[model samples]
Target: MRVQKIWGADIYRDGGSYGFCFDSDDGQWYEFFLKTRAFEPVSPESHQPPIIYRNGCNSGEVVLRLSWEEAQAFVAPLRYENRRFMELIDIVMTSGGTARRH
Candidate 1:
């Protein structure tokens, strides 16, 4: 998925880095991290979104904040449906959310 679609969403900042939270359909939250330097240039410019590149490095990698089981349990449903949960998790994980700047 393109990062621009959710550019206006909440961005978490920690020290010199900034991260955007993405809620996956599978009930997981993924944080896409970018350096302060990288974000500073594009954050102030409205004409175009930031340019980010993931070159098999940890900096631009997406990290999971919650697992499907953890997230499902957190909501605490009145009744448990293992079968339905499994089916939905499989589908959701297959087409997970992504963030990329073009």
Candidate 2:
């Protein structure tokens, strides 16, 4: 597949689905499920849920490709609120109550 880089990991995308390959880590790649907001690792002979159809069909082939921006657009909306909330929590934790309203 067409390799894309995001957050130091090689990313593969087919529509909203994503697979992240980190060479520094183990021999498995992480597949992100949009519906559940969860991830599963895909190994050589042990792929859970059998990966995705497009992914399984196009394995190692660059047939289906989406730009990084398109991928981000599909993913950003999924976690935008959570990311903002996490930012708020970070401020609360690091700002020593300075960022809190009285």
**Number of backbone collisions per candidate, in order?**
0, 0
Tens digit per residue, CA lDDT, model 1, 1-102: 222222222222432333333444544444433333333354432111122223211345433334434433422332223443333233223322222232
Q: Candidate 1, which segments miss by more than 4 Å at Cα?
A: 1-15, 37-102
Model 1, C-alpha of 76: deviation from truth (Å): 34
Model 2 pairs in collision: none
lDDT of 2 by residue, 1-102 (tens): 222322221113432222332121333333321111124353321111212123333354332243333444333433222332333222223321211221
What's model 1's overall lDDT?
A: 0.32
Best of the candidates, TM-score: 1
Q: What is the lDDT of residue 23 in candidate 1?
A: 48
Give the alpha-carbon lDDT of every model: 0.32, 0.28
TM-scores across all candidates? 0.24, 0.22
Q: How far is candidate 2 from the true structure (C-alpha RMSD, Å)?
A: 15.3
